[model samples]
Target: MEAILRIYTHYFIYYDIEMTQYANEIKISADNPKIGHVHKPNSEATLMGVNVNINSDGLRDKEYPVERGQKYRIIFLGDSITFGWGVEKEDTFETLLEVKLNEIKPTEVLNFGTGNYNSEQEVNLFFKKGQKYKPAHIVLFYFINDAEITPQKSKWEFLSHSRVITFFWSRIQGLMANLSESKSFKSYYSGLYSDDQQGWINTKKALTQMAQYSRANQIRFDVILLPELHNLNDYPLKAEHAKIITFLNENNINGIDLVPFFSSVEDPQELWVAADDAHPNKKAHQMIADFSFDFITRGIKWEKN
Candidate 1:
């Protein structure tokens, strides 16, 4: 009986509670022709058993005025991780960092994160909506997959109804794709930066545009490269990280890699939302907030010459 209980616990945590199980019911995304998509304004839903609320501005934070109003306004851009997927809004690094920074002075860190957002979409979103916030600083929480092309929602309606089928179908498709390309996960990730990949090309252009705009406007801008939390002890994506950092340096943008802070953990899975879902949990978000608080408060000068 004890052994059966253990097995059931394992299955529930590692398999039954996966993101694929709840992907169907989350209806926060709204189609936007200009920048691909954005979260539906004033939307609220339960995603992966966590409450997700979108403000009137379509951001994942509380609504704020367009004017800075003597507050040091900071805007963060990224995908789901930055959106605090599987985590609460208060537990998100952005919220934590905002609280920490406000201790020093008046500050507001606005979260402009969305799921499935690539660099192009993020930058475009900033120009379209985020600029009106009059942020004094901008931070892009860049994940490894940000260079990939924007993904369209799957049109398979049936898959949405059955979690079991959705899970199996995803696994099967992934296996087939890997087999057909003769590519492992490492190779597949590294291949995203190939010279011919339009996604990577567009990513570079988008980042460059952001850096240039930030400089011209005198807004301090930086990129915090969020690591893939799958494995931290022996990270296999160092090469990809270096490639991104080099690009940032060439474009005169500061890239802060957060891998070392996370890699120090003995077991990376402890920081995950679930055994199967690698999105950072509340603990990981706290660590990020602590580290970022120091960095942001230091007022490091990023010279663009």
Candidate 2:
């Protein structure tokens, strides 16, 4: 009876912990009208054996000076993946890249990633807060789902306490969404890029805004396209990639597609945060950092001090 009880306790704890932590750490930001939410300032959360600490400025990284002081600062904007998700802060690509770039010259990479952010929200956040850092460069990690509309804060706050309940609820919601739209995941993602889709339209508008701002301000800007992790060997989202690249080219924005980087992985699942979470693991982050390091060093024309 004791052994059986311990097994049950472990099972319950494993399922419920992450949900509770996420709820405690994230808050709806009334000030963030465009992004809709932000991390709780100076708070900490542990999810899937990883610690996420938000600074006083409500950013995931260490506190940085508001003023750029002779250091070449690079600002990274995106959703959760860029936020490091389930990965450690030191192992994240942003941190790794910062270290690598600083080897060549004084550099700082500011991570402005927020979970569940669409393209519009990311750009909005940058204009609202990120520009204060006066970064020399900007890198937007564009995930495939970033074209989707900004997700509203969940109304079922009470259910967040129980991962079991949240799991079933999400499953039911997906079922309803499928029933309503009758579209598979691939079809749904493809539909987001359709000419009439407001999400895609707004994404383009936001990208254009960022690109123009970068050009006008003499700030180097690049968009690194992040691939969907389910299947990397034969990525099925090539069409979406082409569409984004074409738009970037037309707008004179530098774009880097990262899909090919992970294609060599025989089993993409090995790079996942967990069996359930599709966010990249440490290995994947290292791969991104290595590739980004090479790209930045090769492409960026270093300004002599």
Candidate 3:
């Protein structure tokens, strides 16, 4: 009897272990580049190093290893939104841009965009690691969302306690268990409640300081401002961009402003953005890619190529 009880207890223990939840990073694959993921060399510190695929994909779980003597490298730097949230790896703007470039030019572009990264960290990434790559063009993708203070409030919590976001998402799943038939309700509630994206004001010079560094090194710099799904003229963010743009101009840094593009969005809901999440889908990425390719290859004259 005693032996049987002990065996049952051990079985329960093993069963519980199998039910454990996994961290978000665990879902990424090091070999597959088509899933459209972003990875960090290390994520414990404030300043993190990220490896994204500019050619294979906009974001990649695997690292984009640079050849020792490869010439003409382009580095894409940005946060999670720039990292392509729910989209697959091969469909990102950076990857599309690289394909377009390959059709016209003959060079490799490396993307280093990571999730939950701010411009301050991006500057660090370029100064610390990008030089090793000897990139010809340093394209920094700055989202209006970066102005928020706590970008990874949920993911950071998941690092310590996966149950935090897990439970919340679970409850949402339960609430929508029966309402799955309704797309609008599913989208609205999912967007509103899943993540606590309360945007907060932070210091604005993060990008300006970055601009100064890239400029001093005589590298071609372009700041692409990725607009959120929300309206462009809205408070907090629109005003936020004003401050960043002013700083860029004050320092004479070239940048792409997308406020005009936001006003032109016809049916905003068509941009479901991966189940009402901030990450836009393939269509949005294509639009951004078209805009970027024209701006980079045509609008700006690069002395490197």
Candidate 4:
């Protein structure tokens, strides 16, 4: 009875997700021609931390074609934002960028984004699952939460956004009755928060690895600093931005600060990022693509450039 109880309370109660369990981008459906090949839109159901965040990459096992004589393979690696979070797969920024980049550089673009995937998971994915394409440029998208907080145990173990467990954990942590009343389990719950810490650390490590990986694999790298719903003005823009820029600069890597451009607007609704989702909408993706093009060209004005 004790053994069964232990098993039930331990391993059976929680488990980390594996790469195999993920639903990869399968096909690009043209039915929604204007929107492109969005496999699944309006997916309300979430699995763990991922399902609630509906995104589709429109990928398959088969290799796709690149433009003739293209020397570089540019791969967009990140979470649902790269996967076009709330937008249809066709309207994803990567796809938009593909249309735009072709007009700029002699490179091919591949969109390899997914839901609930952190920076470490993304880097790991490129080496293992996405090796076939042999990427030359990896664009690491950013969210403010990437640096400040860690993924909860639910996020680490599950990979979805709608976890009430972590919320409860955060709320209950300060409560004497919760943590003190159940010392053993409370300690265990507290330890779970480290996963987010580890995730943030992994992000830095991944950034460094990106520079090395680019050289080792002959790829150029850029970090696109995205934002959460928060406004940058409320935060220490100069100091914090300096820290980030310094980090990337030390690595001799370029970073495009999307915060200034994104934060200029007043309407969070206008941003078109999914209302409850982590990714931006079609318009926002296009704006990002345009901004990326301008950054690559070393120009400020998208229209003038």
Candidate 5:
């Protein structure tokens, strides 16, 4: 009976720990009017066994003050890919890039990446919150889905603090989205390649504004085009990619396309977080960091004194 009691005690302890961990997963607040959502500042959460922390500025990193003559600040702006979803902060490409750039010169890469952020929201975030940082360079990690408009906040958004509810809700939403044969999904996935949709137009406008802002501030601006995993193999969105490239060329913005490099891989599937998630894994992040390091040091002329 003593052995049975010991086993029960151990099981209870393990169960409690598991519950606590899951409970910490939900750390986002939906009260932001500018962006649909923002990370809860100074909060810690765990997702896919990876720990994430949001600083006082609601960024993914720890508190970092922006000051001139100390370190060159580079702000990375984008969606979940740049946010390092499904990976720890240290495993993120932004952090890796920071480390690599610091080797050449003192630098700080501020991660302003937030999940579910579209180009419009990202641009808004930069103008409202990020501009105060006064970064020397801005890197926008452009994902195809970034063209989509931000979803309106629902009443259920208030329950986002509950990890259990959020997790199950997310799963249900994913399932519904997959099963959806709606025109919106079809237009987004298939029609976007050929048609010049409003989303694409808005995305271009946002990018242009961001570029213009950078030019006005004398900050170097670069766009890193991140491709979807499936699109990498067959290149379903060639037309869309070309349009973006043309836009960048016209705006005189530096665009780094990662599709060719990612597609050149023997197996692009290996770079994904999981079969379902489709977010880039650690290998992909490492490759991006390496490529970006090369681009920053060799491709662009930096006035690093």
Candidate 6:
């Protein structure tokens, strides 16, 4: 009986660990002429043991009808980071920011974040769908990789549905990514990070348009720059951050850089979901919410109409 109980305990622990590492199975529907592809509406999935719900608008939030003048709405735009990848809907920084802001004033945050979205896709999504929400403010969360073009869905994406397979597959992928000198990997990285690349040019144009739209509509636009987890300690992306800051300045867009704060942390890895997965964990989201809360209340001019 003792041996049997010990075996059962081991199995349970293994199962729990496996589930925790399981990546979310995002159900992608038909390609959108505007944003390429979007998650199926009203879909449900679990990522890293956190449940996710995609509302009718293909956003990771509760289904709330857009009724202008009822509450002050702030639209959030970005890729998987703003979408709360590897975390539950409520645990997202946008959701947390909404909750925190509402405690001070009546406000609603509309999250328009989606996985694999670059700056161009995010801007397109806003004009195509998010404008109906009647947002007074727009917060664009800029991740370092937002300048890169979205990659094609892997043939093995379907296999990710199995938690056990995903766990092992992710490990294998991580191992491969670390061997950066491989021919295929070098080309991929070069395309993404090259300074004179078209991807960067496209990103700048989209952001500039977004800024112009905000100015014309009298909507407050603020950009929150997020850092890649691996570089937080070494701070290797200063040049990239500077380029983004220069673009924001030229466009007259308000911006905040979270790199300095994250760099000060003793163990940046503690803020990440996993060593393999660089997405910010729940604690990091809370930090972001707190930081943005202070920035909004103090740095920005937001008055209730």
Query: What TM-score would every model get versus the actual structure?
Result: 0.85, 0.88, 0.64, 0.60, 0.81, 0.81
lDDT per residue (tens digit) for residues 84-144 in model 1: 9889888999998888777767788899988778898899999999888878899998988
Instruction: Give the local distance difference test score of model 1.
Output: 0.79
Error of 4 at 34 (Å): 36
Better of 4 and 6 by lDDT: 6
- The alpha-carbon lDDT assigned to residue 24 of candidate 3 equals 41
lDDT of each: 0.79, 0.82, 0.56, 0.54, 0.74, 0.75
Q: Backbone collision count in every prediction?
A: 0, 0, 5, 13, 0, 0
Order by TM-score, highest first: 2, 1, 6, 5, 3, 4
The 10-residue segment of model 4 with minimum total lDDT is 12-21
Give a tens-digit lDDT track for model 5, residues 144-256.
Answer: 78777666666764464444554466567768877775533434655543446776677788889999888998998988888777656677776667777788999899987
The best candidate by lDDT is: 2
For model 5, give the 10-residue run with minimal summed lDDT.
13-22
Best by TM-score: 2
**Over the stretch 1-305, how does candidate 3's per-residue lDDT look in tens digits?**
43553355334422111122112432232332211233434332111111223333323434566553444568888865566554565777877888788675565667677665666556655665567776777888877545444333234443333434444555577577656755443243233222343322232455666666677777788888877664434423555566667767777878877656667676655564534354566788887888878777755443433
Clashing residue pairs in candidate 2 (N, C-alpha, C atoms within 3 angstroms) = none
Supply the TM-score for candidate 4. Answer: 0.60
Any runs in candidate 3 off by more than 4 Å, and if so which?
Answer: 1-23, 26-71, 150-161, 169-204, 232-236, 299-305
Consecutive 10-residue window with the lowest summed lDDT within model 3: 43-52
Q: After superposition, how far is residue 139 of candidate 3 from its true place, in Å?
A: 1.1
Clashing pairs in 6: none
Candidate 1: list runs displaced more than 4 Å: 1-34, 153-165, 174-183, 300-305
Q: On residues 64-121, what C-alpha lDDT tens digit does candidate 4 reach at each position?
A: 5533244456677776577655465556677777767656455566666755556665
